[model samples]
Target: MACMPDSMRARYDVVIVGAGHNGLTAAAYAARGGRSVLVLERADHVGGAAVSARPFAGVDARLSRYSYLVSLMPRQVVEELRLPITLKRRRYSSYTPVADGGLLVDTQDDAATRASFRRLTGSEADFEAWGRFYAMTAEVARRLAPTLTEPLLPRSAVRDLVIGAVGEVAWRSLFEEPLGEVLRRTFADDVVRGVAATDGLIGTFADVDEPSLRQNRCFLYHVIGNGTGDWDVPVGGMGAVSGALHDAAVAAGASIVTSATVTSVDPGASGVEVAWTDAAGRTRGVTAGHLLAGCAPAELERLLGGDDAARPGGEAPASYPEGAQLKVNMLLTRLPRLRDDVDPVAAFSGTLHVNESLTQLQDAHAQAAAGRIPDLPPSEIYCHTLSDRTILGPSFARTEAQTITLFGLHMPTRLFRADPDGSRERALRATLASLNSVLAEPIEDVLALDAHGAPCLEVRTPVDLEGDVGLPGGHIFHRDLSWPFAESDDAAGRWGVETEHPRVLLAGAGARRGGGVSGIPGRAAAMVVLGSAAG
Candidate 1:
C-alpha cells in the first residue's frame, strides 16, 4: 500500500525533479520497488516538451510544437506500463513543391512511393533496391530496440557472459561494411537515396552525405512499429500520449508537484537537498537518498552551482548542438491549398519537406554551421488538422482544416548582420514567405502564432533539454547509433537513467541512448535503483 504524506515531511527514499515522461517513469519504477518517491515538475503540468495545450480559445495546440511525432519510444516501456494509447495510425507522405509550380508527393504505399521515385529518377531497379534497403534497415532497427530500453549493463553474471559473446559476433557482422557504403550499394537512384536520408538528418546537424549512415537507421527507428514507415500522432493531439504517461505514473503511487521551480541541488554527505519556490513564492526544501534530475545536463549543472569540474573527469559540460531551432504553431481558419497530385491527408501524416533537394539541404546545414540562415532555407511543415479531423471539425460545425504545425529547421538563430528584433522579424517573414509559396494561401491572416527560438525555449523549459535536442552537435541520436560511446569507463558512456554519481541518476534525454518521448530512461533508472537496493 502507498503511504499517505505526513505533515511537512521533506524527505524520501528518492526524489525525482522534472515531470517529463522520463522523470515520471523513474518515479513510478522507484515507488513500485518499495521506495518512497516524490517527483517535482517546474511546469504547472507534466510532459515537458511533449505537452498539449489549447493556445486558441477553442483549438488545442502543442508546445515545442514540432517534436510531436513518436516512433523512437521503446515497446517494452509501453508494455510495462500498459499505457492506454488510442493510436491514430496513418501512412507516411511528403511533398516537395518545385519552383516551376510542380509538386511531387511521396506516399507510404510501396508501389505509389516507388512510382513517385521512378518519376523523379527513371529507374525501376532503383525502386526495388530502395524497398530492399528499407527492409534491411528496419530489421537492424528492430534488433536495436531492446538495447535502447534497458540499462546498458548485463542483468546477471551468466547473462553478462552470454551477451558479451553474442555482442562479439554481432559487432563482427557490422564491421564488414560502413553504413554509407551499404546504402550506396543498396540504392542506385539519388532521389530514392535522398528520401531515405531525409529522416536521418531531420533533428541532426550532421550532413546527409556524411559517412555516418548507420545513424540514419536510428532515425528510421521512430517510424517502424505503427504499421507505417513514418511517425504518427496520437488521436486528439500529442498531449494525449503525455497525458497517458502522466496518468500511469500517478496511478503507480507517485505524486507530482507542479508549478514548482527548483533553484538548487545541494548534494550533501548523506543525501541531496533540493531547494525551490512554490507557486505562491514560498520557499521549500526536500531531501532524498536518491536524486533523479530530469532537467537537461546543462541546466542541472547550473542548479548544482555551475561546477563543471565537479562532473566526472572527461565529461564535458553539455552544450547546444550547432543548429538552433525556431518553432511556429498556428491555428488556421482553413486548410492550405494543395496541388492536384497532393493528398490533403498527406500534410498531417508524415513531415512535409519543402524548399530543398539533398544538395540544398547540405548547403542549408553548412550555412547554419557558420551561424547564418540560408537564403533559400529548408522548411518542414505538418498540417495536424488534416490528420485529426476533430480538432477544428467541431468548432466549424463541420469537418474543417484549421490548425497547422510548422517547424522551420536550420533557421539562423542569428539574423544576417542586423538588429535583434529586425533580424527576427525578417527571419519570420522569410519563413512565412517560403511556407506561403507551398501553402495554398497566405498564413499571415491565421488565428494566432506562437513562436520561440533556442533561448526563449530554454527560458520556458530546462536549458539542458534544449542542449539535448541539439545533442552531439544536434544529431538526434546523441552520437552515431552504430558507434555508441563505449561504457567501459565511468567518465564516458553515461546517459539516461544511469550516471557516474553514486545515487544520482539521469531520467531525461541526456542519458546514454538519449532523447525521445519514450520513457525508457526513467524506467531504466528506476530499475537501476531497485536492483541496487535489492543487492
Candidate 2:
C-alpha cells in the first residue's frame, strides 16, 4: 500500500531533489521497493535537461530542446518500469561532405557506405579500417555493457576485462592512448580521422593529447551506448522518455512536487532533513531516510551548506565541468539544399556532419582552446520531424514543416560567460556561416518565422542552459564522467553513485558511466538504497 503525500506525516524513505529522468527513475525504484518516495522539481514540468518544448513563440513544433537523442538509456530500466517509449531507427547513420561527392554512411547498405568512404578518402584500405574499428567498438560494447549496471570494478580488473573482451592491442590503442592519436593511426585520411574523433569531443573541451584522457572517456561513452552505440530518435520528441519515466514513478506511488526549490539539507546518522521553497513561495521542510542529489555535485554541496562536512580524505572535490557544445533548434520551412547530389531528405534523415573534417576539427579545437569560438564551427544536424511527424501540428504540416536541431562542437561555456548575448550572437553567426559554406543554399532561406517575425531559431548557449535548466557550467553530464572502474580502494565494488556522505548519492550525470539520456545513474542510485535496506 502507498502512503499518500500527507503534510501531517512530513517524512519519506527517499527524497529525490530534481525531477529529471534520473530522479524520477530513482523515485520509481524506491517506491517499487515499498519505500515512500518524494521527488522535488524546481520547474513546473519534469525531465530536467532532457525535455521537449516550443521554444519559439507561436510555433507549433515541439523540439527536443536541451538533451536530444536516445543512446545511453538501457533497456532494463524501460522493461522494469514498463515504460511506453518508442525509438525509431535512423535510416542513414552519418554523412560528411568533402571536396569529392562526400561520405554517406547508410545503416542498411554496406556497399554504398564502403563506396562513399572510398570516394571521400580514395583508399580501399581506409574503408576496411573503418569496418575493423567499428567491429572493435562493438566487441568492447558486448563485454562492457553488463558491467555498467553492476558495482564498480577495480581499475586493474576493468583493464583485464577490456583486454580479454577486445584485445590488449585495442586496450592500448583505444583506452590507454589518446583518441586523436588512435584515430590518426587507424585511418589514412585526415577527414576520416576527424569524423571518427567527433565522438571524442561531444561535450569534452580537450584535445587528443591532453593528459587527463577525458576525450577518451567521452569517446568510450559515446560509442559504447546500448552496446552498439547507435543513436536512435525517440518518437514524440525527448519529452516522451521523460513522460514515460514520470508516469512510471507516479504509478509506482511516488509523490512528485513541482516548482519546489530545495534550500538546504541537514544529514544525520538516522535521517536527513530537506528544506525547500514551494511554488507558492512558502518554506517547507521534510525528513527522509535518504537524500539523492539529481542536480550537479556542486549544487548538492551547496544544499549541504558547505564542503566542511565532506569526508576528510574522500575522492578529490568533484571537478567543475565546462561543456563544449552549443544546441540550436529551429523550425525549417523546408530542408536546406545540399551541396552534393544527395537529397536533403537523405542527408537530414540521419546525422548530417558539416565542416567536421580532420584538420578542420583540430583547428576548431585549437581556436576554441585559445579563448575564441572557432571561425568555422564544426557541427552536426538532424531533422526530428522526418522520423516522428507527430511533433508537427496538423495545420503546420501543410507548410511542409520540419524541425532541425544543430549541435555545434567546441563552443565551451567560457566563450559565452563574458558576454552571454554577444557571444551567443557571434556563435550563431559563425555556426550558420560555417554551415552555409557546405550547403547549396543558406539555412536561413528555409526557416519559418515566429509570430514575432523573427526566424524560428531558438538558440541555447551554455549560459542559457545554466540559467534555465540548472546545469552548472552548462555541462550536460553534470560533471566530468568518472571512469567505469573504481579509481580508489574506498570506491571499489560499490555502486558508483555513492558519495563521501553515507546517506547521499548522485542520481544524475555525475555518477559513473553517467552521460546521455541513459537512466543508469538513477537506477544505480536506487539500488544502493535498496541494498542498504536489505543489509
Candidate 3:
C-alpha cells in the first residue's frame, strides 16, 4: 500500500505488474513494438530482488544485497537491449579450506589447479574426475542452453539430447540419481565432492540424496548458464545490470511508475482491468489490452480477484516452498586473514568456501531438516570490491576497503517461521561463528562499523526476504525452478509464459526456465504479446 502518487494512463496495450528487472524488460519490448505500455511496481525503486543498495547507516558502499554475482544472463539480451553492463570472470573459481593449505580451483592455470588438488587431497583422482564431469556437463549445456529461448522442448526430447551429448553413463548417473550420489560416486575426496555438490544447493535446501532430484534441477541451472557454468562478477555491482535494463525500458518509451503497488488484476476477453493504491492510500485503476504478471505466478493469482483468484490451470500451488539460503552483506575495512598462506586478496577474490566438506554439508542438512539450525552452517564467501572497486567510494579505494557477500547454504525458511526476529539473531550468530571457525581471527575484527558502532553487516534471513521483497516464503525462484522442458501438452508449443487466461501471462522467475536475473521469462512473455499482434 505504500507508494508515491503518480497519474496512471487510463488505457494501454499492456499493463505489466511488478516493475522488477523482468517487468522492465517486458515493458521495453512491448513498448518498442509500438504497444502502449504501463509498468506498475510495488517498491520505491526498480530491480525487485536484484538491486544494489547501501544497507548500513553512514556507509559509502553500494552492496548487492539479495542477488549477487552474474552467471546466467545471456549475451543476446544484453546486445538486444543495448545494456551497458560488464561482467568479469574470476581467474580462480573456488577455494576450500582443509588442514594446511586449502584447495584452490584456479581457472587460468591447470598446473596450479593440479598442484593445489594434489597437495590437498594427496592424489589426482578427484581432480581427474572433476575434469571429466565438467566436460560431460559442458557438452550437455551446449546441446540444451539453445533450447531455453525457443518453445518448451518435451522432457523426453531434452533427455535424449543430453544422452546424445554425454552418453548413457552420465545421463543415468546425473539425471537419474540425486546430485549428491553422483558427486559421491565421481570424486575420491570429500572436499572435492562438497565443492561440486555446492552448486546443487545454492538457493535450494535438500539432501543431496533426496529422491525428488530438486538438487539436480538447481545444479543444472547453475552449470548450464551460458553452457560453461562460470559465475562472473559485474564490473560495477549488480545495480549496473538493473540500471541498464531500466534505461533500455525508458528508451523504448515505457512508462514506469514507482511506489505503485498493484492490488488487483482482472482479465477479460476485451481488455484487463488493473487497480492499485497510491502513496496517500487513494485507490486508482487502469485498463490494458494484455496483462503480464511480472511478479511471482502465485502473487499474480492472488491479485486476480481475491476469493475468485483461481490457481492457474486449477493446479494447487505448493503449500510451503521455502527458500533455503541466508544472504549476509558486509563492508569490511580489510579482507580477513585466512589460515592459508595465500594473499588475502587472492584468497577472497574467488569463492571462499567454509565448512562444506561433503559429509559436513550432509550433516548440516540433517540438522536443519530436524528443525534445529545447523551448528556450523555451510557457506561460501566472495569479495566484490576486489574485482570492482567502483562500488566503494574514493575513500574506500584509498583505504583498500572491501565488500564481502557471504551466502550460507541449507538454512531454510521454516527454521525462522516460528520466531522470526529471534531466529535471525540466532542464525546470524551461528553463521558468523561458523565463518569464524574457518578464519584465523573473528570476521568482526576488520568490519567497518556504522555511525552507531555496529559492525557494517546486514543479515537477510529468509523471513526478511519473504517480508521485504514480496517473495512468498522468500523462495528466490518464486517457486521451485521447473526443468526447462515442457511439462504439459498445453504449454508445449507456445511461449513458456502463457497462462490459461487468453490475455494474462507470466513474465517473472516463476515461469519455466526462470531463475537468477536472466530475464528469459520477460523476453518470452514479450514475444507472446508481440507475436499475437503480428499474427
Candidate 4:
C-alpha cells in the first residue's frame, strides 16, 4: 500500500474506482455534468484487458490479450467522442476451413457471399436463403442495440408500459424459440447456419442449438455500426482505443490515479469513504458524495466486506456460469503459410474461425462445460501482420508479425488443477503445435509465444470472474442486456447512481446498463445527479 499525496484531500462529488474504458467513460460523463470526479486504478496502466504490451523485449506492438476484437461498440459514442480511427479497421469477415481442404468465407456483400456459399454447398437457393436470414437477423440486432446500451427500467408506470409494449412486439414471434431453429428458418445452407450459430456460442456456455438462445442476437449488435459485417481492430492496437478514451476523459476534467488500489469502500448515509493505496507504501482515505465502482460486483462485494456488508440483492445478479478463455499471442519471424487456395492477407485481416462446423463448436463447448480442455478446440485466429503491415517492417526484414489466437470452451479456470505458470506454457505449446500442422515449415524457431491462463488473466485483468473485460462480466452492455429482466435487480435500473445517495452513483461497468467503453453509464450517472440538482 502506498500513501496519498498531501495535497489530495479535497472532497469531490464522485469517486470512481478502476480506470478501465468503461470507468474512464463514466468519469468523463460525470465530470462534464459539473461534478468533480476522481478515478482510481490498481494497475500502473489503466486499460485493463484493452492494453498494448510488448510481448518480446525491445519490440513495440499492441496486443488485446483477452479481448481481441471490437464491433459491439456504439457508433454514437465513437462519433460524439471523436475517437481516432487509425488502426486497420476491417469488418467481421470470417473464414471456416473445412477438413476437406475447402474454405467458407462470410462477407458483407450479400451477392458475393452467396456466390461463395453456393460454391461451397453447391446450391444457389441455399446460399440465397442464407443471405436473407442474415439480413433479417441483422435487422433484429439493430433494433435491440438501444435496449442493451441504455438502462431499461420498467419500474416506473410510463416506463413499464413502454417496455411492455416493446417486448410484446419485439419478442412475441421469437420467444421460447431455439436459436438453431431461428437460424434454420433464416438459412438453408449448413455453412451459413454454422456461422450464425458460432456467434452465439463463443464467449458463452450455451449450446448453439439450444432453445431461446436467440437472445444472443443482441451481442451481434456490433453489426449495427457500419453494417459492413466485420469486426474492426483499433489502429496501432487495441490499446489505442482505450488510450484515446483516457485522454478524452482527462480532457473532460477528470483526474485519473493509476497504480492506486482501492481496498475498501464504506458506504455512508450521504457519501462513501474510499480507502486506497498508491504506488509508494502508504495508506489514505478519500470521501465523496457518490462512489461508482467499475470493478467486478464480487470484487466490490468483497471490498465492501462481503455478503454481510452488502445491501440485500434487489434481484439475483445474472448468472454468468464459470467458463475460461485461453488466449495465445505469438510473434512470428516469418508469415504463416496457408493452402494454395487461401489468401493469407484475407485470412489475417479479419477473424478466422478454425474447425468451424456446428458439431465441432458444440463439442468444444461441451468439453469446457464438463471441466475438460477439448482435444481439438475451436479457435479464432487474427493475423495482424497480414492486415496491418506496419506490425512488420516494410519487407519483414527485422519485423515480427503478431497473431492473436483465442481458444474458447476449453479448460474451466475453476476446475484446472495446475497453477497458471505450467498451464500457460502447456496451452501455448499446444496452440503452436496446432498452428505448425497447418503451416508449410516448422514455426518453433520463430515463435515468441505469450500464453495467459486464469491466474495471469486475474493478475493482469481481474474482471474475468465478473465475466468480461469490462470488469464484472466482460459484458460491456451490462445489466440492460441480461435476459428475463423481470426476475433481476438489474431490471429496476435503480443502480444507486440516482437514488437518495445523490452524492454517490454507480458509474463503472457494474452499474445500470453495465460495461463497455461507451461511457453511457458514466454519462447517465452524471445526468442523474445534475438533473436532480436542477430540479
Tens digits of per-residue lDDT, candidate 3, 416-521, equal: 8788789989999999999998788899999999878999999888778877887876789888877888877666777788888988999999988898988889
The 10-residue segment with the lowest total lDDT in model 2: 308-317
Q: Each model's C-alpha lDDT?
A: 0.58, 0.85, 0.84, 0.56
Q: Each candidate: RMSD to true structure?
A: 6.2, 3.4, 3.1, 5.8
Model 2 vs. true fold: TM: 0.96
Instruction: Name the candidate, 2 or 4, with the larger lDDT value.
Output: 2
Q: Model 3 off-target regions past 4 Å?
A: 1-8, 306-318
TM-score of each: 0.79, 0.96, 0.95, 0.80
**Top-down lDDT ranking:** 2, 3, 1, 4
lDDT string for model 1 (169-189, tens) is 333223334434444566675
Score candidate 1 by TM-score against the native.
Answer: 0.79
Which lDDT tens digits does candidate 2 get at residues 204-248?
A: 777876778898898888888778888989999999999999888
Top candidate, metric lDDT: 2
lDDT of 1: 0.58
Candidate 2: lDDT of 357?
80
The total number of steric clashes, by the backbone 3 Å criterion, in model 3 comes to: 1
